[model samples]
Target chain A: MVRFIDGDTRVLVQGITGTQGSFHTRLMLDYGSRVVAGVTPGRGGMVVEGVPVFDTVAGAQDRHEIDASILFIPARFVLDPALEAIDAGLDPVVVITEGVPVRDTMEIVANARLRGTTIIGPNCPGIIKPGEVKMGIMPEQVFRRGNVGIVSRSGTLFYEIASHISRRGLGQSICVGLGGDPVVGLDFIDVLRWFEADDETEAVALIGEIGGDAEERAAGFIAGGGFTKPVAAYIAGRTAVPGKSMGHAGAIVQGDAGTAIGKIEALRDAGVAVGDLPGDVAEALGGLLKG
Target chain B: MKLLEHQAKKIFLDYGIRIPRGELVDSAIKAREVANGLGAVAIKAQLPVGGRGKAGGIQFADSSDDAEMVARGLLGTEIRGVEVKRLLVEEKLDFSDELYLGVVVDRRSRSYMVLASREGGVDIEEVASTTPERIVRHAVDPVFGLRDYHCRRVAGLLGYSGKEMFSLASVIERLYRVAWEMDAELTEINPLALTPEGFVALDARLNIDDNALFRHPDIVEALRLGGSSDLSPREREARDLGLTYVELDGDIGIVGNGAGLTMATLDTVALHGGRPANFLDLGGGASAEMIEAGVSFVMGDSRVKAVFVNILGGITRCDDIARGLVMARSRMGTEKPLVVRLVGTNEEEGRRLLESQGIPTLETMEEAADRVVSFMGGV
Candidate 1:
């Protein structure tokens, strides 16, 4: 039983006429996601991959019972689509578009919080519940239905780490890409709390990079007895030097607060099984599960 | 997007924050003339990073002739890998009190934090570490912004009183406004000095968000002007194509999936004595066309003796990247050394596609970097 999404969840595609949205919508439907409708604004009355299209998210909701939405809108128009989806009463919205301005993301995040809607990312790869629904760009073949919940900041890193777990015959209950942007909606602790409460998730894998104190904060939460399930973690950019800003503007370690070594040390001290290499992540989790 | 002191001061001036009179001059002769005209002047190297004074990027010239000599020596010299093309000649101020003020986006709290301190002209990090009470911080609401009351509260924390308190508070307000209006990620005044004349922003460093450039055409144009002209032709081409590329001191030029991977690749190269010639992110979901452009850009750099293609395909399909690589190689037609590490969906297909075309494929990112550095003769 994957968390956040399953066979019961009805999905709608925003910007369904776009190449990526159409392709992924078809993929999601084939993977057993109950994709009910698509929204293309002005391209209404059309059909994409057997899903009916409408002008707005409200129109799409009127036509189909869209419990959740996966947005594929361009970066500039991401905020509008997300707000529209939330306004239309979509429970959870997965935003796959990257490069949305931080200001726009802040507004979207604030609005989503106000409306009690879950907005995943404006720069993320979206989420996937193996064997039930794949709402993101993750390789479906690599993920299997299992009890390990995964959350990551980097999309590609998530897939690679998930592949490592999949090779060990241990699949994920649900994998969420929180996006690498500084102003992304959900934090590591937010996703961790969910995984902690989910009965399906016996353990969790957290993929973090150098930047922000999110990992350190998550470690504090775990150390404070906020989480009972064992967490296997891997922090990237360990060998990276300080004062060099990474690609994500938010990932810059200006002072001593944000560093890979600092984060790894904090997590290690917090009783997390930290993996030194990508392939070793599964082994770390296996050890934790055994314990 | 780090703005030099003079450029940052210009933004500060626009926001009604007072700054010492300054003029940017490129030649030593001009520097001498400006210094002489200003009477008592501070000669500062126009660089993007901090610790300029400690790095010898800043000097106080007693006479116009001395200013000229220093300016000539600085221009065309490299400071922290960035060439000093110009010098800012500013009138030095006699300060009654010195303070520190800055507005930086606190990523942890997801808020714009205003940092103020009565003790100025020193590194804020050092201040935070030693006497943490000296640094007073207040998170500004993005919606309401930095109000007068909020500034006063911060000023009170810094132990300011009377006119000095009022003046410092106003400066904080103005700085916060500039930071918000300009979409700046960081706006710092190292020494917000309280002179006999008034409160002045003695040193300024502003870093604007690169993503918000479209809305700020003026700032964008100003940044372009301040930018170095020593950029490679391919780098210029890539910039014109709207890709973010920054050259480093690395021989293994990397073009990758995202900014994070590009930087990680740089770190890997640096660990192996290979300086990455540039940080080029083809962006997520790069097509064959973009890859061709990226390859051309990387190969265009003479310093880049080798190229590393590190891709983690998710939404960006490995096959699509392979097609781009094949297209880029054929189009460029230069057998410049290449190392490719493609992982994720359709990785095997991507490997086969590249191998069929005789391009070398590595199993891991570390191996690819090492191989490229080795190919460059231990660069």
Candidate 2:
């Protein structure tokens, strides 16, 4: 089975009447995701892309047991819908909206954790299991169903790497973008643990950039025997100047703590093959797979 | 979105937290007048970045003459890469104790955590590494918020008792409120001084969250005003067009979609022997208008000798990027060498659009880097 979602995963679309929500809901349905219901405050009793719209998640959950929920609401209104989905017992709630405030994210994370719910990104390209389910905003042509597990903190870069892997005759089991915000759901360590447990994922490729200690923490976990699969890694922003926020709130170089060199060193020390550039990652992973 | 010291202190005053009386002055003569009224004062440089005291940006003076001399020494001078355009002259305080207090989003816990330490007047990071036990931390539940009991527990850890305990607790509570209401990533009052009168926030620092700025229009307007004065010409142009741009000390201008990819482009350009002059992210699903703005913004930078447009289209289509480049080149009439790397959705069409215009495009990041660096004389 896939880690978060697969062919059998019944979905409820949060903010489904909105532009992005409706558009992606149609895409997910086309990709064979079992989208059972949609939720919009005042748009209930309406049909969006052949899915029934309900007033709230509770109303949607009343008719069907939703395995997951994808949020496409505006940033300010995302927190309430996220909490409502968590309380309603959705396993892996995916938030596709960007610009979620840190405090709101903190509350959502805390409440979701207390209830054993998994939240994936407030600003991210969501999960994609190629040929099975496409639950996020990523373009589908780049992915091919296969054995490689891809996890990244970037939206376009994830697509870039995936296209390279697909071109190299390698395909993905499941790819997840953990978002670019300072605080996000499902970090590298969490995704790595899930990839380790999934039998379908033969190898893992982590696309981390300069930011925070996420890559370092993931290195620690891999070095400590937390994951047994062969891992390939690529880190961006080696030449980024310190004290500048490089678009992403989390992709800032604060002194030397979150620099690309430090992250590369940590991953190298963990016996993981580190690509000097994103182009090199696929070749490095191919070598690892053969060895 | 880091606020200057005086601005943070103003926010503190709004929360009923006592701050040392201060006046912001743009000239040394004005600083002298403010200092003369206060008797004894500190002339601190108004910059958003920290470590000003260590950088000699902060000076204490006993008289108006000394204050003017100190302000003259700091005004219009560069400190830690920032020019000292303004000085915050404030009345010095007499204190019996100096305590450290801060509220930050603890990434490890995924919660807002308050840090308290009896040892103050030094770097908190240094204190944490040297003496971990001296720093007390309490993770607050975001839903429940910073309760009085939580503040009391923090006060107890700092060894406060009775009236001082209540005073410090309430001050911490108010600081948390300021942090919460302001949507600050970090709210710190280093050396929350204990005078004979009460606990006063001697030094204040507030780093507001940029994402949450929509909830606070007042802060956004203030920051916009501050931006116009503080931002460089290229920066001001980029901000006007909603592009993420940061100037760097290099020669090659780099632009890409998404933060990670933009940074990667910079690194790739550097790897191939070219230094990046700036980092500009066109952002996800960026329109042709946004790309036009980004290209012209980079072209405006005098330091940039060459440009690299890196686009890995996911939600952002490659055709839009190509059309934007073609339009920008025709409209702006710039002859700067631009190396384009377009991949993913509609890439072939995008490349054709550029190739038809005599603008050669590369297929890979490595090829784009090699080409761009070659255009810049290989260094």
Candidate 3:
């Protein structure tokens, strides 16, 4: 009953021979993810941690019914792998590689949209559902089975908050890292729509940072009665100066709209429970649940 | 990574974009020789970001002696945190018209946009915000490439006519090619001047996509030559290890689990009157070794009087981080104070581990920031 991934979702790993890909594939497999096949252009017929490898995504898809794919290719080859996966009919592609060229990412995102395929990140940690299946690079031990649906732009921050919720016995239904790229595939509102429809997800915890009008847009959706789920949110980079570019291409505070103050105020005005600290996320959700 | 004006202009010249004849010099003697070769010259201090003219980084000189004096005064000065190590001495020209030309990847639209204007020598953002009608924008198709007609239309919108129109159009096409070929995120030629002689780029700025560096070996070497190696040693190490680290002007060093948390830590610090010194993301699946390395890296910076470790456990366990912190402290013998906010799996065990070592642990990010700020004598 998890949001994006579950036991039934078959997965393919691109660049499976790479250190990061292989390492996280093992973790995902251990956490019950149905990792069906692996793809590495010249290394066909090899097995990485028991997952069958093929020369191309098309070759792997022929052997397995892949519902989703996780790309571990380097920044330079990110587009090629993603295009290959999408062309092979992978419905949702989760890109974990960072530093992808902005031009290349724009093209890939547009192409994915045209194809009616979902792309998670070109520079982000993947998604996970506690006690079910794990995708991307998040550690598996800290998560626990629960009803809070989590979404965030920062991978590490999402994992930390997931752990906090798990520790407080406030388990999560699913946690999605929408990525930190400026032009990501899915935004806050998109993930909120998914969480709102999921029966297992009783409440939502949204972790946002300074940059873009994503938070503002999400607040608008809530204000417009877009969802009835109790929502708890945390906005980061409050003191970040405007016009200064952060490490993540998407983490810049553009003009006056993307500031933390603006986002926090908007979310508060929308009647969403806003937590002040990472640890307070559980308390905020609890308050929302009570209301 | 931002390049100085001279460096950007050199790349522009390589791409056959017409620019004023110029030579960058580190000393006043070289500046005098270059200025002597060309009668009236412009002495521009080479600094990395924009608004340099308003910062008094550029000056006009009628003679070689005046140019040398200007260069001497600028060479050792600091502008906008960047030291003026060199001066770009170029031939001054009598221009009939000035225009703005730039190519940038618009994230909102997910396309490469070409912007041109009749008004020049001003910030493009200000122009776009204020006089929106004066600027013209065109989105280029990557598959078709930027066509000559596209350039002509942009020039026409800028009120270009005669030889000035044709020459400006040619320059626009060439610059667009450079922007595409070099994988540039932003390429700007402000004051795209048109003189009686010909059209020339008076000022240039090119920001290459860092992801494309592996494909462009030549630009990697060119970047190395600008004496712009300003990143700290720890930051360089972090980059080599495939981590994202940005140094800031603050006293509290932050090492966090995610980019969001790191940024939140920075905000929390500032909200509590404590400045954050840097953003160091250890990424997800942070092992004990990576945590140890991240800790030592932050402690190495003398500007960081205190360190704040913020982690939300997820798959990365609190106990694992606690062990890494202890190991790093023992190995580096860090005397600088540390405040940690650890929550998630094994929280109690992690707290006990740190408490046994007499290390302070805060329950929340706000309290950790407050403790660090208070320890540093209230910011």
Q: Give the number of the best model, judged by TM-score.
A: 2
Tens-place lDDT digits, model 2, residues B198-262: 99888998988878888989877876666414456677777777889988889888889988888
Error of 3 at B106 (Å): 2.2
DockQ of each: 0.42, 0.75, 0.49
- Tell me the docking grade of candidate 3: medium
Best by DockQ: 2
Q: What is the lDDT of residue B210 in candidate 1?
A: 70
Write one digit per residue (lDDT tens) for candidate 2, span A1-291: 223988999999998898888988988899889999999999999999999999988888788878899999999888889999999998799988878999899889888878888888978999999999978999999899988999998888888788889999999999999988888878999998899889999999999988789999999999999989999988988888787777887787876668999999999999999988886888887888777
Cα deviation of B176, candidate 3, in Å: 2.7
Q: Which ten residues in a row have the lowest lDDT in candidate 3 chain A?
A: A239-248
Clashes of 3: 3
Residue runs of model 1 more than 4 Å from their true location after superposition = A1-3, A59-64, A86-89, A239-245, A255-257, B27-38, B61-78, B81-83, B228-283, B292-312, B328-355, B358-379
Give the residue spans of candidate 2 off by over 4 A: A1-3, B25-37, B64-86, B224-231
lDDT of each: 0.80, 0.87, 0.83
Q: Which is better, 1 or 3, measured by TM-score? A: 3
Q: Arrange candidates, best DockQ first.
A: 2, 3, 1
Instruction: Give the better candidate number (1 or 3) by lDDT.
Output: 3
Candidate number achieving the greatest lDDT relative to the actual structure = 2
